[model samples]
Structures are given as C-alpha cells and as structure tokens.
Target: MTARIDLTLDCANASLLAAFWKTALGYADEPPPPPFATREEWLASFGPPEDGSEDDGAWLCDPDGAGPRLSVLRVPEPKTAKNRLHIDIRVPGHGTPAERWHRIRAEAERLVVAGGTVLAESDGHHIVMADPEDNEFRIAANPAA
Candidate 1:
C-alpha cells in the first residue's frame, strides 16, 4: 500500500499567497467558497461564519495537477529569513530570453503590486520574489544557468 502526502505553508495571508502561486506556478485556487451564517430570518443554507480568532483562512491547491495538494496557513507573524522548503517554477520557453524575461517581468510586476519584492535573478534564469510576508521564491524556466 502507498501513503498519500501533501504540503502546507504557514503564511501571513493565505489568499494573497495562493493567488501569487496560482499565477507563478499555474495552479488553480481551490479556496473553499466563502461560508456565512444562516440567519433564521433568511431562508438560506449558509453554514457559519469563520472563527475570526482561529487560523482557518488557509489557501490550498494542486499546482502540477498531479502532486498532492498544498496549503498555506494564515498567521499573524511575518515571515523572516528564507523558507526551509521553497518552490521553483519552470515554464517552457517559446522564444528569446528577452521574451521569457518579459513574461517573468509581468509576473514580477503583479507580485510586486500585491506586496511581493523582486530580489534578483540571473539573466535567462529567473527572478527571486518574496510574498507579502517576505517568503522568498524563485520563478524561472531554466533549470541551469
């Protein structure tokens, strides 16, 4: 018998990190649809409101569409230093290095707008980015320099 496995990340903003990874790795955001409290006055079947005090707002997804799902846990403390485990993304290059850079650049721009920092990357390699909580990751298609 084989055992299944999954990955989980404790992050500052689960939703934000999910979105960033969704784009960076082509993963679908499978966030559980919002659940609201079903008021007696209303005839809707809403479950309940999320516990504001718990670490419940987490993000999850299956990036490769083959591997087990990964989750990001929302927390109060900001991320410090580098992650013990990190994800490296690779996309099939269609044309020039400049073209690839452009695609990566666009992603960097969006991530930056969403509170990510562009650290650094080698030419034709990839760019280093940190999430809102400063969790660093590399986005690149090249496997070697």
Candidate 2:
C-alpha cells in the first residue's frame, strides 16, 4: 500500500491562512478524530502547552478526499524568506491558447479577491501569486488539451 502524506504550513495566524486556503483549494475544515465530537474536545485531551500558550492551528481536508491534508500551525517567528516549495493551482481546460489564458487570469482574479496578491504573470502560461501571509504559489494553465 502507498503511504499518505499531509502538508503543513507554518504561519503567524493559522485560522486566517486556513480560511484563505480553504477558498483557494476548495477544502473543508477537517473533522476531529474519532471519539471526539469537536476539535476543542480533542485538543483538550492534550492539555495546555508547557509555556501556557494556546494551541493555535487548523486542519483542512479536500472534500473529495483526493488531495493531501493541510495543517496550518501558528508559530512565533515571521516568514523572512521565499518558500523553496510551493503549491500550484492548475486550471485545466480544452481551448485555444487565448481561451486558456483567460481561464487562468479569471482564476487569478478570483484568488486576488480571496486574499492573494499577483506577483508576476507569464502571459499564456502561469501566474505567480502570494497568499495573505506572503507564501508564494502559482496558478498555471494546463498544457494538456
């Protein structure tokens, strides 16, 4: 059997990032593990942190169960450099180059309204964008037709 993987993102505000990602990726808030009706209840089992800080994090899962789970955790330090790895949101469609680019730009605009900032564009290829926390990601037009 193949192993499943989950992606974790460190941020200053987990809830805010989670909300943006949920909109970007069409993911839903992950349900608490079995035997716990609510996330608060499950977290309570772990007790408070050693430093007495609140456990600030959010978990998200693809509604279709096809994508890796995402975990956004709150951290003390701010992001100072570019991310070596980033997510690519693909816009796949069967159309001419112009049509494909339109689709890509449309998605990028939607993301902009969802708290993303467009950094660069490659015309008919892809667009680089940054999330609310400045994590870089891409919106690409799929070459497959």
Candidate 3:
C-alpha cells in the first residue's frame, strides 16, 4: 500500500503561519471531520491534553486533494536556524526564459503581499523567501514543465 504523508511545521503563531501558507500554496483551512459542526467541538472529543496544556494548531489541505495536508502547531521556542527541509512553490506554466522568470517574480510579489519576505533571487531561477514565522521556502517555475 502507498503511504500518505502530512507535513507539520512548528511555529510561534499557528493561525498566522497557516494563513500565509494557505495563500502560498493555494490551500484552504481543513474543515472539522464529519458530524462535527466546529473545530472546537471536534477537538473537544479528544478530551484535554494529558499535560493539561491547551492544544493549539492550524490544519490546512490542498483544495484539489493532491498535496499533503499541513499542520502548523504552536511551539514555545522560536525558529533559530535555516530549515533543513523546505517547500518549493512551483508556478505553473510554459514560456520563454524571461517570461518564466516574470511569472516567478509575479508569484513572489503576491506572496510578499501575503506576508512572505523575499530573501534572495536567482535570475531566471527561483526566489528564496520566508513565511511570517521565518520558515524558508522557495518559489520557482518547473523547467521540465
């Protein structure tokens, strides 16, 4: 059987990161499971955390159900270093090299408006960016596509 995977990120603010990621990946807030009217209600079903601390997190999923779900969980510590693993937001299309780079820059600009910061740009390649919580990710156009 094929294994399914979900990506989880540790951040200081779950809601903010989730919002940024939603905009970045064209994902949406995952609704509570069936029979539950609200996320709070669904969470309540699991009872309180064993340690008595509140469970704080945001869940997101690809609207088309092709990508892995993302979970942003609140953590006490801050992000202190570069991410060993990061997400690559692929801009979809085919065009001349200049046109492709333009598309990448356009998407990067949109993400900046959505609370992402562009760290660096590789000409006609990719743009390195950071989400609101400083999680590093890249925006690029697939050369093969």
Q: Pick by TM-score: which candidate is best? A: 2
Ranked candidates, highest TM-score first: 2, 3, 1
lDDT of 1 by residue, 1-64 (tens): 9988767878776767767666655667554544633222121344435444233444456656
Write model 3 residue lDDT over 63-130, tens digit each, in one string. 99999999999888988999999999999889898999999999999999999999999988999999
lDDT of 1: 0.65
RMSD of 1: 6.2
Against the hidden reference, what TM-scores do the models get? 0.63, 0.92, 0.90
For model 3, which pairs clash? none
Error of 3 at 55 (Å): 8.1
Model 2, position 83, has a per-residue lDDT of: 99
Off by over 4 Å in 2: 50-55, 143-145
Candidate 3: list runs displaced more than 4 Å. 49-55
lDDT at 136, model 1: 74
Alpha-carbon deviation at 28 in model 3, angstroms:
1.0
Q: Could you give candidate 2's per-residue lDDT for residues 35-112 as a string of tens digits?
A: 999988888889967663334899999999999999998988999999999999988888888998999999999999
- Clash pairs, model 2 backbone: none
